[model samples]
Target: MTLSSLPAPAAPTVSPWTLSAFWFGTAFHWLLLLIILIPANVVGFVGEANKGTYLGALTAVGAIMALVLPPLVGAHSDRTGKRLPYIRLGLAVNLAGLGVMALAASLMTGTNGFLVYVLGFLLVQFGNNYATAPYSALIPQLVPPSLRGRYSGVMGMLQAVGQLLGAVVAFAVGTLNLPVFVSFAVIAVVLLVPALITMRGVPETATPAPELAAGPTLSWQQLFSYQPFLWVFITRVLFALGQYSVQPFLQYYSVDVLNQKDGVTASSLLAGCIIVASILSAFLGGRISDRVGRKPVIYVAGTTMALTAILLLIAPGFGTALALAVVFGLGFGAFTSVDWALGSDAMPSAKSYARDMGIWHVAFVGPQFIGAPQGALLDWGNRQGDNLGYTLVFGIAAAFFMLGVLLVRNVPDTAHVKTAKA
Candidate 1:
């Protein structure tokens, strides 16, 4: 069957709970690793003085693996017409990597330990990308257009909750002075349980044989030419760049800027504060976008996030920063809630959902590399005196956020609720 002759596949709607379940685990895994464990591990190995530069370099290297793996995994899964087997394989590898990371943390110290941790982190990235690339296609494959916004909202809410959980874990690690390896063990369980629930609960719909046979092989030229997808992809990258510029260094920011005695606990508290607000906004944003439109919500959300980033530069104390974090969370939650729906709507072909969404996933990881230089910049600005680095980086983040909001205007809106109402 040629593409033109293929009929639309029936959309299989799932319970919101089931639809959102797998993401909870995935979000927990990543948020814990990125926001908490990795920073702490880096500090253990490198100490506070050089943490920013080293962490940036380490993250950049790991991001290379994350960036390269997903599209390949997704394309292969599309060809095989299977997602679950790959997900299982990836999960096993991811667990093994976590174990190695725990070993590195518990046994080793200094540069050697950091290198071993890096090796383990690379493996974790590899496995995560391998699994999630195919997993990302589930939304477009399962949900119909009209319901994607609301479903994506639920997914976002669960993701926020997962981050909140991660923050709690971080707080425990900091306050109790828990062993680093123990934290890894905790994350492993947190990741594993929900993933199993999702895999068992969510059934995959088979791709029609004719459509599989007819699906065009993926090519970079074709991928770039899809205008709507390209615009969405660009916007996603911009938003992520804004986010990552600040995210990896929050521990340092709390210690250096906020003058917190235990930076880990302070950063974790800030993260918890943000996530609490995010949980609420994520649901509301998703539902509201369903009724109103994606673009308008995006405009407001992006602006709010940009302003918050700017505000963080001037926050005089942790208390004031905590308040701003709430505002930031509201914006970020809304953006993330709508982001999945936007990407799903802009997908070029249903026949290659995994491949396309895998590429879309890069929009998130690619920024880790692109913005990696912010670490060096942060170090440099501090050297110049008056804590200039934080100011410069956060300012840049605000600019990136605003530019993303502006560029998103180029993509044609595809909100189903408005279309249905019309």
Candidate 2:
């Protein structure tokens, strides 16, 4: 069942839609491309691109930029005491970047595929990455602590919805892929404009603890000083890398391996299962994290994501793979269920929420650059008769989960920050 079908959390002070907006961002945020790319991410890189390495390198450059932009912009926002300016500017970048990608994709289909493909992908990623930095950090200002877990669940749920919608939508529009993608982006932008307009005068909460902000004087060194916060970045990077490897290859498995005809039925079912499970997991998982603790949830998600990735690799057919998608989504829902709250806790700077989040974002976005191509290459190599190549990639994904377990092990749980209702 979809998380949207689940009962509401106990009375939250923040209007439900506010939290819903936060959660909904996930689904709508990249609703434009994720669905089409998610199942096809692997195929696009390995089979279609035929130049994974070059495309990967370019994607990496853009991904890296996204990683670093958040903290810088956020800190600047903190200094300015305003975030909308940066938000608006970044949104503009997002629009321009999507436009380039559409243009690039259109060009690649006919000829000179390599150069145009790389450039378009790079531009789209660059814009999204840059914009996302400040976007994530802005959450704290919007949601209250009593509702962090619930809010996070909403965020996770919306994201899954986006995936479900995007996947089904993509299959229908694959023939008109370019315009479909552009329209998706355009709609996202339209949604964003209204959201931002709503948030125009809305104030976000800053750090309540004096020690965390240094008695009113905020400094970058103090912000970066928290080692645990840095550790979040470490885990984020691993998560991104592992995710990247699996996402791009899913399409390849369906098309080249399973030999499924290109249709919304197959893609939608695949995307739908993963997202549906993820949203359910995300909703309950966030509250569970709130109850038992965040670290435990992270562990659950990490291991689940890792195991499922491997299962898909070893499984004999699409049925098993589809089943695993549900499992994978469950794991992801659990981890990300409270990930944003955990991320906020790790932030060392009050003023630069976006900046620090942005800096931390690298761990999430960077891997996509390398992971996509690497998965493709491994698949490409395995297609040549070496099982170890693909196996190794999945293995590494699992290893990253293990590594994340270690990274968050020492992190202090925020359970006492607010007790969950019995």
Candidate 3:
């Protein structure tokens, strides 16, 4: 049926959001982070020889899910006209995976337990991506373009909160004892189930797909033809290259380059600084984007963060390193806040919001596919004398960030343009 055939709801001149819309952000982030942490220690302890193979294999599996599931689920949601049901399904998959992981750990010992953990991990990745694709599509629907920046800012804060909470859980559940891991799973479900319950009742108004119904059903090929959407995807992937590449190596950098006595502690402090700064900036930057524009904020953020990547290479001491962390944190926070809003603004088709968003989701997940290659580069560089690997790592990260900034120009910016309603 054509979208025009579908009944239309009263169209608001301008879209706006109440404060409660942001609650989804907090719940989504918290549960996602909690579930991820559940397997981190197991992954980390794999011997160096097999570590690369296991991680590479796992990342490939996870990245495939990341790239494929979001849009698939998103497209499904768009067709079905019910977002929450898919969200609930994804959560159930996630919870099932967590249960199997806990069960396997309880029944098996040593490497056998770890093997089951791997299976569970893959399932969790699949479920999370499926859930996240549909859930993310909700943002554009719930918050109007006029208020998207502010909404994104709140989402950013929620993301920070989720990260902090996840970190706390990881620390608390250190060593991955079977009982502790089980308890961790229980706690995650307890927290997340309620959030899902709350979201189930949040009242999403389904808009008729006039353009979508009139046109051919949304196809991947059709989605890719939109230049602005393509650029948005490119920029996001570039940004991910810079961000995720460094994340895995920071602790190693702390110990080898900074001579920190406690690598883990130092890395955590640096990460904490970045998180705190991001929380503030995301809130502030989103507000600023509302008044100014999304691109300008991203430009400033991208530039600042790119420079910080350089500073990481040159920092002489822990104090200098910590200061750089603050700078990176601020830049990253600003970027995080505006990132999604910009994506929302750049969408090619409102009728396919979830499906289009699923396409956008590839950028974040694409990194997983490429991370092994990036790590390989780091490894190759490290084999050379004088920590050249670290230099190459940060240098590559900086280049990716700059490339993202340049690509930003190609994307049609909606944050600056006003519609009749806006």
Instruction: Go through the candidates in order and give the C-alpha RMSD of each one to the true structure.
Output: 2.5, 6.4, 4.5
List model 3 lDDT by residue over 33-65, tens digit each: 323333244444464434333544555566778
Question: Per the 3 Å backbone cut-off, how many clashing residue pairs does candidate 1 have?
Answer: 0
lDDT score at residue 186, model 1, on the 0-100 scale: 88
What is the overall TM-score of model 3 with all chains considered together? Answer: 0.84
Task: Evaluate all candidate structures by whole-model CA lDDT and list the values in order.
Answer: 0.84, 0.60, 0.67
Q: Please name the candidate that would achieve the greatest TM-score relative to the true structure.
A: 1
Candidate 2 Cα lDDT to native: 0.60
- Could you give candidate 1's per-residue lDDT for residues 126-231 as a string of tens digits? 8888898888888877776667788889999999999999999889888899888888998889888888887887766544347534656647677767677788
lDDT of 2 at 157: 69
- CA shift of 138, model 3, Å: 1.3
Residue-by-residue lDDT tens digits, candidate 2, 93-128: 666656655555544443454355455555555555
Model 1 accuracy (lDDT, Cα): 0.84
Candidate 1's C-alpha runs over 4 A off are: 1-13, 204-218, 416-422
